[model samples]
Target: MGCGTSRPRLDDSDCNPATGSTRKSAAPITNITQSYQRARCSNTNPQRSRAIGRGGDAKPPSYEREDPRRPGQAVLNILKGGLALKREGTVNAFESCKHKRILVLIDDNHKMDRITKRAICSLASFILLIGHGYQCDMEFRWPGYNNNDSPKLGTAGSEMAKALQKLMDTKTWEDACEMIDANDKLQEVGLKTWVENQLKWKPSNDQFQFAEQYRHHLPGEAIRVANLKGNDTDEDLHRKLRVEARSIMAKHIAGWAANDIDRTHLMKLDTEARKKSERDQKLSSNLGFEYRKAMENYEREMHLGADGTPTLVILLVASPITKTEKDSIIDCQRNIMASLGTKVANGSRDAYAMQTVVFTKSMASANLKHFQDIDDAFKGHHDINDLTKVEETKFCKNGPSPELLAKIFNSNLSSIDKSELGERELYSQEILTDGKGDIQWPSHEDVMRTFRPDDGDSDSEG
Candidate 1:
């Protein structure tokens, strides 16, 4: 009997393969008091043997402590107030505390404003809303606005956030417009919309990247969308424009032409009409131009910039045609009308800080927030485009100037860019009424109050 004995094997199953002999078992009896004893190779566990690092095959893993946060996630957490980048404190409504943040979430990102963009995307900029101008801008926390979606990781989240914030700065409007114009990616999505025509873009917090990636190339065709957003915020000048256009066309075409000339044929006649006998053709050629400029001039005179001068932020033709023409002369010219409309809308924005939009159809702008749909929202105050002397005085209060109505019937509209208009081009959608948009829309007061509930409480004391 031995102190460390092994039971005898029934067969030579413990033979060493290398030596072709039975393996020797124990030298185990040597140190009886030792708690730690080295085991013989034969007694070593197979799993433990494999775990030991062998010559030139492998080595044990070595690890060092590190911060667990990803750069993007960390920056995002700070923005959402899940983590603290700045000192933690809570004070008044002026303070950029967690409680002060206003998280604005909209499932629909189709139409957005500049402030909405900043509030949603950029954490750094969202804090800057407080104390921007009139008072402290409450912090607006946009849902899912964390910087996890940047194209690049690491500093990309912070960098992208900063870039988004900077894009929306009041000082950056001109640069942003220019950038959108130059960058084909931006122009594809930006220029086609009502907002872009006014030199505005969606500078939202979270989805600017998504917009850039998926802003598929919309049909490059020209659209027939017109809006009259001008200094007359209280007036539905677009309806007036429609009435004016109808009046002008009706007046010119009453005895001038017997037949309804196809717009395409009329254009050909206008081009070839060097002969005096082609008087009707000549008049028709100038009809679109006349309509455009008269409306432009009307828009120009009615609206004023922040400095009291004419605002020329945008100059779109404000035509009321619903869509591209199969044959209608009415639907033929829409895109160029914006040249005047933009000025009106921009002036309103500059002078009054009002949000304005012009859509061909009431349905086109459905579900949009923070904007006044001039075409869909306001009704015409006058039946005819050429306002009566009394109506004119009532509309402007200071009275209409001779210079403003100078070119009601004539040539020389070279001041505007010609490229905006095209006979062959057409817009992607049609939502407005056929012919002049004479359908009765609601009053301006109701439309304005619909966008902001707090503004309509004039009857109630705070």
Candidate 2:
């Protein structure tokens, strides 16, 4: 039959009578191939299909453009959905959301859930919005939010309060200024007002008195004395001035102690007295003993010319002896006299034959050569008796008695003994040896080496 003539009987075989050979039917084959080509073309040209629709030359539906300034519609939708879920008490929207950050809106009427509050706080950063009727307030809290600790938040005011406190405590404008300047925040408070107030402030009476005392001394003098010159900066000059002012005040206090006999004045010089009094219970008693001893020494020197006074006073003018060396010499002489069966009286003469008086360099009014000649006369004698024959014709114009010479020589011997025993003790054997024989004088070092502490002689104590 012809391919289009009559319908052929349905058969599973691939043979066609029209083709006259074993082949698939052409009509069915053509229909299958056309359907596959259409499908393949549609798959490969998807953009062309999207650009054109059933209407032909049609465009895709466009979305409304988002305003750059306003929140996105998606964000608004999510917020609305979250609020609806929160009202329904389904899950806490802030906790259930996969978003790393979210805005939390709080109103006067809305009660915030604890978990929502904690989640908001735990976020790395978030915006907090508060609604007040028609108005909304927004605040941002980030990783480095410092609550009330920032200098912008009354830190300068707090520092100013502390500076005022220090001002009240120190009562000095300079000290208060220094404290205020040390704080960066307080320094922003300005110094003009502080300076004006300081100028108006009246000093206490004691402060006025101290200022008056140092009124003649210039700040330049302090700078010079402190050895702060070209090398020192302006700040160093100001610091040195303050230190020098303090030192001058201390010196004034010390002068009061030295010149005046008042106990109060002396106590002023003893800055550590209060601390010592706190630590030592017997501090007051010890001070009393020292004062009494000083008074006794003063009285003995004042009454040197009184009767029964065996002490002979010698004035040393421009003597080579220093005060310390002189004192050591005198102590050594007293010890030697004590060993010779003659005891030096503590106060008035009791049984001692003679007491030698040694004057300081300040007391000497005589010629320098006269004192030098006297020093030569008493130089080498070991025995006190031998010193009595020293000629005093050159020492004094009218030659004083040999007994006076003995007193001077004995006093001088004490110094010689101390020198021999103290620093020159090692060479004493060579230096003190006369042509006749060794004087056998004991040095202070030898005495100290042989000395032993007395184990409580309780019977003698009784």
What tens digits encode model 1's per-residue C-alpha lDDT throughout 237-304?
22232233233322122101202222233223322322221322211223233334333434444454
**Candidate 1: stretches off by over 4 Å:** 1-166, 170-172, 191-196, 199-228, 232-462
Give lDDT tens digits, candidate 2, residues 59-151: 432221212111122222222233333212323322212211111111100122322222222111111110111022212211101122323
Q: Which ten residues in a row have the lowest lDDT in candidate 1?
A: 382-391
Q: For residue 187, what is the lDDT in candidate 1?
A: 34
What TM-score does candidate 2 reach? 0.15
Which one is best on TM-score? 2
Clashes of 1: 24
